[model samples]
Target: MMTFAVYLIVFSSVGFGSMNINSHYFNKHMEKLLVSRTFGLAGIRNIEDFWIFAEGPMLDSLFPEPGEMDGNIIVGGPRLRQAKVQNNSCEVHSHLKYLQDSCYGHYTISTEDREAFGPGTTSPWVFSHTGSDYYRGLVATYGGGGYHLELPSNKIDALQAIQALRQNNWLTRGTRAVFVDVVVYSVNVDQLLIAKLLVEFPPTGDALPSWFFEVSRTSLFSKSKDYYIFVCAMISMTFNVYFLLLEACRLVYLKLTYFSRFWNYFDLSVSIGSIISLRFGIKNYLFIASTLDKLPDGVDIPSFEILARNGFNVKVTTSIALSLCWLKIFYFLRVGSSTLAKIRVSVWSCVLNSLGFFMVFVLLVFAFTHLAHHVLGPHLHEYSTLGATTTSLLRALLWDFDLEELQRSRPVFGPMILLVYLSLVLTVLWSIPLAIFARSHTDVMSEISRRCNLWDQWKEMVWGQYSYRQGKVTSEEELRLLLEQEGLTDEDMAAVLSRMGVRRGQHVDSHHLRNALGCLQDAEMLPEVAVRWLTDLKQRVDAAGQKMVALTDKVHMTLEVASGDGS
Candidate 1:
């Protein structure tokens, strides 16, 4: 018994400690990861015409370490160079603009490719950029993920151009491999950082306030899709704690009855598995693109595409985790906490309030598609466009949206009406506390009454047994103690027993009048009434034994006759 008690204590301690560690670890990892995960791919005017901005993960390695961030605005100047058909081949006339001004970041390409614009003169220098473009992905705006193989043998360029103009504008004309360029500012909002911010630039040519991104600590974790998987794993564990720890586990503790603990173990196993799976996912990605002497060519496509796919998987898992959260809220509504009842009862009210958020997502899609339909004659475009607006819509849901706009577009009834309705609906929340208080009060009162009734019967039994180890108890006190132990209080028990004709000095056979108590061990898989009846029979064996005797009509006469015959 001592060993079992010790084991239970140890189990609880370890479980809680593990939960803390996992939560802290996941939080810190997510915080750092969020900073590194954002990379922006923007169209830069005329320096190879485009730039890619990678914020967090993309820069963890590529981004130069601290102090390396200098006070220079322009990092490097890359311009195209013209070369003849000779194989001295490629060179970018890169001038080191190495002073970091307000902020700093490192910029480098795998190998810069600068080519001569025309065969005659090196005067027209042309610079070109390429990046993790090897793996095949569709320019979806042109159509789903199909790459038109540009081979000299099949020269139908005109038809291809026409086909592209007929679909989504997610791409551009003559796009070669995509190049990723990054600019990382020491974005901390300290003295030096904000001083850099005072540089006056006008979006409306000095007509408006400049838009700036402030480094506020909204969450320690990144809003990146990459972190979604781990977030989901943590959410799953939270659900397990709610259902397994708070509810089912408590039920087992109550009534002191033993049953299966399979659900507890199952939830723990899933938590562990999710942690392992994420680690393995990260490893498989970077290691797959290995460069060796035996290998003839470099890896196909950039690594980010695969990383993006992993992010999508995490999103799916996150959705599952959110669903679990709602499930737990519902579970607690039923059996454990009293507060969740009203909220659970009127979730449709909460859902009604959320229609605005839902509409935000839906309307954006409709607006974008309607514009697309207008331009390309119903979802067509010019210049094999790939990513214009639809992708932006999906991204907006995950990354916050502009709430100010939502505020302006108040529905016809006004936001107040809906707000009031939501509050009114949530009024059901009153039920939870009501139920809990009622249950607790009722249980206490009933226990007191029961113990009081049993008080007298218990004293009689104790008195009968008292002579054997006797102590003075006027029948009343002994009966009171027994009734109290059965959950009846002194006053209530006195009143009830008085009504039952059990007075202070009464002495009667308790066995004849005692109502069988229900067994705590819920054994049978049948109706509770049936099980209670069976338990009563098991306890009254002595009464059953007396029942074997029978009264005969001529029993005494028969005995007299028998006596005479013997004489």
Candidate 2:
């Protein structure tokens, strides 16, 4: 049950389900924000012109049933509530007021929308300065005829013109003043709704702001609901604390020798990593939150924002520690079942004992991989680099088996060469390691069986010595002799006696036998083997005791018969 609980904790620590929930919640609104920000048709001097430029043929696809252009903005909101628009001849002033009153319709401009006249150009005969010949022709034609017109071109050319107009700020006053409105949004349904302070750019210019941009709520520390994040942090800290306490108790009571194990040091390191990760995470979050509170509109805080979004140093360290923690679950297999224990022991023994075979396998792979690269490098791009060649060969060995690529690269000899390479890899690299593992498995199993059998025999010897001693003390020599008589040789009896710390010629009693059994049981010796061996040993001891008793009785009866004859 304790092992099961540990497994459950390890699985739960991944927290992938919660992460998925967070992603789904944010993705819905993020898509809307991306659409509104990237393709939002606001602040364009000519909606039709910008649409033609941005979307090309896709313009019709976007607005199939064109009723009116989308200009979703409110002028007299929080930021513009205190501003007054100065009189200006620019058509944009009229457009702003039009939006405030009607709040609908597309924006358009007349042909005489010139900011300056060339020195040589006549009145109503506008001259082009920093514009294309196309623009100059349009200006001359419009100035001569006094007719309002929109440019006609394909999507590609129109988009280029629109880009030029935006860079020049053709719609603003004098192209000198800039205005911006920053709206902080919290997600509502599938769209962003304004939740906090509205900030306008050019704090000293005309109190009216030009356009707006949306930012996520997490940018503002006060608005971000990071309570769930904090809760997760607390859970991680609690888990680490539990780990430290357990490790400390083991070190204190299970002997200081417990700390010598690699796993104990590993657990300590992960616990330390968890603590440091949480510490830095909280510190960085609070720092970002404070920075967000001080940020002004139209100002960027890229570093802090990215840190909050992706968790900076905290994510790396926490992930490292968490991955290590999950791997620790395999340690429990050492105690779970006999098969599990055998598997763990077998794998380690196989890998360590077969290092020479593994080295040879690597040598073969490297050698043939370079040979293939030399032959196929010019034809096959995957063989262009040594790393790429190694990867391709390794993949083929694993049965990814894309020999067709080689055939395509080299039409005549590729198939034959590939067959030879595959044979070498299959026979030398794959078969050799597999055979080593199989042999090592048999050897390890035999060793485990031999150890268990010795444990059973040792327990039987201890029981036999205690019974034959007849509740009195007996030397180790007597016990060794008795066990030797029972088929255990001097060497075998000495090995068992040494394990039990029974010095030669040292006295042993029943108490010693009971203590030896306790130790063997604690060491996880097979219980059924010990029980069966002890049952048979007790029967043998009884038979020996009865024979001794019968011999003594016969000697007494003979003495009595001799005394009666003398009388």
Candidate 3:
């Protein structure tokens, strides 16, 4: 338990530090982007909308005019790139189909292509900036590719760069999506903040598709000289390794029986997961930091999308492992406390017994889901698909349904259908599991009580036999001598004897003395040291009694020899 506490402390410290640094960077960049007018680029479906956003307001208010900014502003501030499908011949039946089909073949334009186009070039891929000229060039070559547009620090150069991309067939049917990466470096803290904006084109949408934006941050000196983090890492690794070995030894000792216990699985999983989470978390942090440091100049800046994804993976894995670690605390508590142990048994039994009832409940929900989907799918958006219908029905079971909306969709049937679902699921299906758990809990409590009574009876019987044997070996004199040696005065002995229900001068055995000592201890009349002295004195008195008997027998034999010699 001490080891577990130390490990958790170290792990939490490292996790908190990393989270603080990353969240600071993320929020700083996200706040700026959220307040920017150009952040609504996700709604850009046409060239007119794109131009309105690009030229209307600056990307970041802090650096409204890139040319006016101090040298502190990083050179790799903001850039744009687009991904296009290479093979446009695939027959896309729906929006989902288009997404999946496009995934099979898409490519972003390389850094070399952008560099070759040179500054002020109208078209990067072709001689002319026209759509026909670009199409002709694509057909002559590999048929399709993406474009990289570099927006220099100066406002004029940046606007010119935007014009170059806008003149081409960039937002055509072949285009999959456009990405805008904005990187800002804070000289005060030496931290790099990044924001990635993704704008995807839908196959069949009159309104523009909603855009996605992700923000992340990393520190420059974090990886280099944080000795505290290094120490935490070493300590965490050591504990994880120790736990893994301990679990492995237990598995070997228990063999297949080890899997029968649920907490054993938790033990093994948390150990392995902690190790992997830590390893990858550190590796990804360093990798992202290094990538940010080596970012190329011009339009050739590398995508931070993959690096951002790696960081997200680290967060998710670490969260799961840490949650499991905390949950394992309950396992230890359950083992140490009888009340918790009984609760665990009752809950587990209830789950096993309610499996059949759960199956029926699921079937009922499934049937209602299909019924709602078929009936209201055409008119109501909520029940448009099977998945959506299931969600709506489940929500309705929890009284989250809108009766007005349902009635508006289908005035007569909608309310009736919901009433039936709620009545059956809430009144019938849910009640069975509750009853099962209640019954299991009662049975567990009764069984524990019966076991407790039986245990008490067994203890009483064993102690009775022990007292009988002790009475045969010890007597009143021996008890009195031992009590005196234990520092009991004559008055104390008389009072103790009175408490034991012994009359004046009555015989008292070792069993009676034992009972007296127990009463004194319970009443706080006897200290632990006195009890130990009494125990030692009792043993010494018994040994002395045996020696006296042997000596009396020898004297009697000597007296018989002397009598025979006189005769």
Candidate 4:
């Protein structure tokens, strides 16, 4: 029974571990997808120019504009609107070849522009007016020249312009920043074509801050393995619930009997906690995925990243819960056959014996902790506090001492103190306690073995083919064959039969077997022990039977005399 339970727990843990690995990879894939959508679209394209233009009011429309920032502004582009045509604006291209040549090696915002704009000037054409450092920095770096400076008619035109830039190598997939300059006219706003020009540049090794707004792709769910995650979570939770039910049934049936064991509570706690943790973990991921599904592309949902991070945390918790659930495998080794039972007993005996050693070791550790804190605290940083001293000593106990720290302390004195400490801790205290525990473990096992031998002998006699008026009768040839199979010689069989006093062709019963076993236990020193015991048992039985017959006769005579007197 115990073996079966152990196999079940092991199989469940393996399944859970596989699911955890899959979920981890799934999270990584999702993160990569997010990064591709957010950063890949605006990467630097042209090596020489290091500038890519973004057309129209791209991501600005996804968020509500700040009231303090001007509504219509072009941050880093030409101020004229198609040379101000009479009825409609005509496309006019401006040449900045002279300016580009001068700023080839020194691509920077014009000093006059910087002074006039003053970091973040609120104008219809100012990029920093929106108060976004990402766009503002891009405008300051690459918005000087080699820009399209066009107004897009719609969002599609804006997407096409970005895609064309990427294809033309003017906008690489690795660019980190995109600058947009929008010019909104209060009058003739519809004819103005609410559009902005974006300039992208390569990142300077510094990663974008977390608060930076990011664009998301439309097919968020398609890139993730949420289906597999959900399935695994469901399967794992179902198994945990099954275990919970089993524990409940055991509690109901065994009542106090089940509660008496410590492992029962451990299993119950793991089962309940795993169920709860897995449920909440699944809920968190699903909620985040659903929320992301409802959001439009290029929309900056601030909570999306936060929710993703929270989901990852829950995933870690679920993994930990799975790990804790594996502790139940130990509970299954306590029952079943005598061999397993003996193992359980011996292991528990070792644990109980080790407690004494642990108690003594803890006291010694505290003493050393105080000594280290006082003596070595001034010289070594590790020993500066009582907690630190205790921690250092604990690590030292495991042979993980920091040699550098010891060497850095008062050179000779530190080595001498450490040597003495190691001598007391490793050589004497550690070895002695472990040795004591080992001795106790051996002694307990030896005693258990001795008792188990007697148990085996009794069981063989009472249950095997040797009991009197019970169990199967074995012929002499059959018995000889069995002994031969056990590696016993013919002489050994003959001696055993002689000790039991069983003649040729006579059936041997439980009495003969019991006597033979008793003689064996005493090294064949008292072969007649079982004979004497059987004779005594027979005499007692015969006496009791005679007493019973007499009692019956007396009862009948009393009844007949009473009837005659009545007549």
Best by TM-score: 3
Residue 42 in candidate 2, Cα distance off native in Å:
30
Candidate 1 whole-model C-alpha lDDT, 0 to 1: 0.33
Give candidate 1's total backbone clashes. 48
Residues 1-567, candidate 4: write the lDDT tens digits: 554355345435433543434333433332332223433323324333222212322333322245633333322222211000011112223475444322211123332122121122333223322222212432233332222223343445545644554465432223333333332222212111112234333222322211122222212234345455455556667777778889999999999899898888887877776776666665655665665565444322224444444444555665666666565545554443455565566567678657776777778788888877888898775887787789888788788877777777767666666677777777657587667657766876678565545445544643454443344455555566655654455676687777667778877566776776665543123233333434555698999999999999999999999999999
RMSD of 3: 15.4
Task: List, residue by residue over 1-567, the lDDT tens digit for candidate 3.
Answer: 777878888877666656656455544455444333453454455646655566544344425555745323544546565544444434556767745664222333321122223344443443221111111111122112346555677666776766766675455555555555566555655555455555554333222333323334555345544668767877888899999999999989999999998788888898898898888777876876677566554322344545555677777778888888888789668755767777788998788678878888899899999899988888886897787789899888777888998899999899988988888888766688888989999988887665545444433533464465565535556555655754777876677566566664666565564574455422123343344444555689999999999999999999999999999
Off by over 4 Å in 4: 1-226, 290-316, 333-340, 350-352, 378-381, 428-430, 452-567
Q: Cα deviation of 163 in candidate 2 (Å)?
A: 5.3
Q: Flag the better candidate by lDDT, 1 or 3.
A: 3
- Model 3: residues with Cα > 4 Å off, grouped in runs: 21-51, 54-63, 66-79, 83-148, 167-169, 174-176, 187-189, 207-217, 220-225, 296-303, 368-430, 463-470, 473-567
What CA RMSD would you report for each candidate? 19.5, 20.7, 15.4, 21.6
Ranking by lDDT: 3, 2, 4, 1
Cα lDDT tens digits for candidate 2, 411-526: 76677767777897688776777787788779878887766666667666666656766455577877776666666655666655765678767887666567656666532455
Descending-TM-score candidate ranking: 3, 2, 4, 1
| Candidate 1 lDDT tens digits, 306-393 | 3334434433443443333334334434544433533443443344434654564355455544443333332222211325345433
lDDT of 2: 0.50
TM-score of each prediction: 0.30, 0.47, 0.65, 0.44
Error of 4 at 100 (Å): 57
